[model samples]
Target: MNIDVLELTAELVKYESISRATNVPVTRHLAKVLRALGFKVEMLPYTDAAGVAKLTIVARLGRAEKGGLSLMSHDDVVPAGSADDWTGNPFQVREHGGKLYGRGACDMKGPLAASICAACRFTAGDLRQPLYIVVTSDEEINALGAREVVDRSKLFADLRHGYGVICEPTCLQVVHAHKGSLGLTITSKGRAAHTSSLKGVNANLKMIPFLNEMRKVNESVLTSRRYRNDEFKPPHSEWSIGINDNNVATNVSPAQSVCTVNYRPMPGTDTNALVRRTRKCASDLGLKCVVHRTGSPLYTPKDAPIVRTSLALAGRRTPTTVAYGTDGLAYSEQMKQLVVLGPGDIAQAHTVDEWIEVDQLHKGVELYTRFIDHVCVQGLA
Candidate 1:
């Protein structure tokens, strides 16, 4: 059977590429498709040994030395919570009412299929700059796959001429800016002792007041008028306490406690300032807490050449900002101009019965074709 875009979507969904399992199968499958299209392919695997596995596929469709265009995407899909939540088997592809339903359908497999279809359609004589297909295994998990690809100096250096397109689902819209994220862990340490000793210090006791104080800090965030960017819904930084680990019997005083705080910072917000304030808050509570900066935020100018070209191809005059963050943060400094354009709505991603409109798939393939043609084939200014 021919590997058409829709058929490719079905094949990708058949493999349970959930983060908890191996994504090697899906990456290998995509590599096979790229290879059939006459692209040179390589495997860039990432493993932490403790069960975290990531893979990125790099394929070049012409002379490697020539300047090339790169299309990147992730193959991993977030786990489908509660099998009962889905109307059909989560792993099986189903079509209903003009939509294709399955895990990773919209969050990215659909776009990946469309991109590959566009590559197969392009004629040899039409090519100008080389076209590169980059498939990674862990974008759902903090863009781990893309991170590994960018870390390699040689990889980034070789394709520097190509304008990078992150084919993440955006319902065919072009996204230019996304917020940054910072995760902080707060820990409280104390001496453990028998409950009979009333004077014994219980780390749990210290945490109560501090936790209450942290609530105030979280509330303060909702009221702040700083870092305003009205383009995003409830535009401003958002703060929340992620995890609180304090479980102990009443007879014994617990020795340790931890609190994880996540902040989705708005554009231009001083992340350092927020981190410093959180550390001070912990100190005042008499708890020693260490704050670690998580990921960098991606910011691209609206007037950048690549952004202009992408928007023009999509027939839009302006770019949009999304609330979620992407690996774009990691490479923002080196690749200053970037955009996230793909098929599907972010709402369907990571949800049971995830799906992508068939029409979106068609539009995506055409968009990729036009984009590649304009940037790589025609080299239009």
Candidate 2:
């Protein structure tokens, strides 16, 4: 109950748990702290494609009661640029003028600390239901942690029908929906040939139609405008090329070309249909669409009780939506309610010398404590 949310946030920022760096140490660190706080902690470990170790820390306090509450956060931070570029050590927590400056301050570590502080207070207040702290790794790269949790939902059997709060920076606002995303690096291979002879197939030329086909897909999505939600910017699904990798020489034909395609699936857009149309295009073109990253969009109903309650707590008339993604959407279907709400401005996230206002951190702790009281303690509707 007496937890120093700001101090705890500073301690967490001291860990260099960047996305490229494994989060095992910080996770272990949090696990120890949670254990000391009388919470049951479990570690879910796995190895990524790069052979990097990853972990998901699920800590619970109170009975293993269904319909409990979950406070979610991703522990991984984006890479801090060169030390010379920063005014202070990015890993070392620095507070100046009431702003906590650190790599993950605004991005997530601050919110995670708020959750921990709230959990301590809520536990002391006599919780009727369980309190779950879902700290996942590898969220910056993708929704790896969310996917793992969904796949292994049975591990946290207590919170089966729970509501979720992804502690992503939202300036104390509530977000109920965002676009889902999938990215692919597709390649077309062809034989090399001399420019004048043209004896070999040109991969660059071969890729044009495929590229155009993808453009058509984008155009189709834009024109159809299915499931358009005006709350979101543009209000339409999107498909487009990201990186145009063409292996071509001025005098010789290109033997291989690769390009990155990305899809932002709007809520209600059929992801299966999108992928099916994509694969069909690749199949017909004899190209490969190698999927590299993907995540489900957030579309928690605006009228959900949790959303309505969160809006009321935030003193807002309507639940706004973020254009970017968060960890909650990936697991929204698992629960009756999920909302992305936290302190700090998302605009500050991923910026150099990232910081969260000290006031925001305080407000976050208070907000999370209220949520715990409403959902975890009182079991209010």
Candidate 3:
């Protein structure tokens, strides 16, 4: 099969595989594409929290051996907030000034297309080892699909010593480290009644103390050197807090209020201690606390074989770190050598009229092909 990176990216962008919905359609399409390229495809299917069916695709070419190259990308993209904000349809790929404009064009689909095209460049007979391509779901919201790939995919299980690349937008730069994610949701419950009768307990009132404590924690995280990692730009763990009350009218007291907290953990940060601290606060306030998600940071040493090879392939002198997280967090558990490298700019992701440079797409294909050649075909690193 002859795969063109631009055309494949446009085809993938046509599928509205938003994080909230099922990614099965786009995943199946990719699976078909991989099969056409003589890849052995495996389907890992699961249901999301909303009871919607989702899928992750794992495809391999050449020998099913212990060591090779694995390229991973998420199939899900963030919601195209409003059509009115875009030049044309957000799902329709449009080329303007040598940039491909679409929802996942810069964020991931373009890099994903480049990976597919690179893998298709060689037939199975030409490979000394295997080449793995993984398409995961729910990367925009949570990394549940990547977790599933780590835990469930039999094909992935064979790549214990393999080199893995998370194809996230990095302008073709190599990333060796990124922050982790820890999320918490706290809920305060109360009885609902009319404010005129003054019989209802306001949930927001109960949540105020908790919020105040969280604010102090946030402040401390922002200022404390203990949570700082100088390798990243901001240096401190980014602590974010969000609040919501279900009541729509002032006449009625709110029956429930929710507070969501998100914290980014750097290397050496004690995430378990952070979770314990939040839980204790919620317990003292008699509020329900739930840990929604936790993902570890991807940390490969700059001298690691994968990082060095990826830096060489991208023509970079050193490996860098990013503030954002990727699926590497999950895959890193199994594959000790992993790096995040791909095309386009991270700034272009999740914005209105998102686009990726055509040159980046072509460069992405070239880089991935070099990586495959170095590892899978030539069996180097």
Q: In lDDT terms, which candidate is top? A: 3
The numbered model that scores best in TM-score is 3
> After aligning candidate 2 to the native by TM-score, how far in Å is the CA of 241 from where it should be?
0.7
Please, what is the whole-model Cα lDDT of each candidate in the order they appear? 0.78, 0.82, 0.91
Per-candidate RMSD vs. true structure?
2.5, 2.4, 1.1
Q: Between the candidate structures 1 and 3, which one is better when assessed by TM-score?
A: 3
* Model 1 steric clash pairs: none
Instruction: Sum up the clashes in candidate 2.
Output: 0
Q: Kindly list the per-residue Cα lDDT of model 2 for residues 294-373, writing each as its tens digit.
A: 67788888999889989877788888888788875567666658889999999999988999999998999989888888
Please list the residue runs of candidate 1 whose C-alpha ends up more than 4 Å from where it truly belongs after superposition: 65-67, 123-125, 191-201, 246-251, 283-293
lDDT of 1 at 20: 66
In model 3, how large is the Cα lDDT of residue 188? 99
Off by over 4 Å in 2: 153-155, 192-201, 244-253, 291-294
Tens-digit lDDT string for candidate 1 (1-381): 235789989999999988767898889888888887788787887784456666677888766553567787888888988878899988889999999999889988899888888888775456777787888766665667776777763556666556878888887788888877777778887767787987557676667877787787677777766656777776866678764545467777777878878887776777776677778878888877776535666777788887888888988878888888766755565676578898888888877788999999999999998988887788773
What TM-score against the true fold does each predicted structure earn? 0.91, 0.91, 0.98
Global CA lDDT computed for model 3 = 0.91
Candidate 3 global TM-score: 0.98
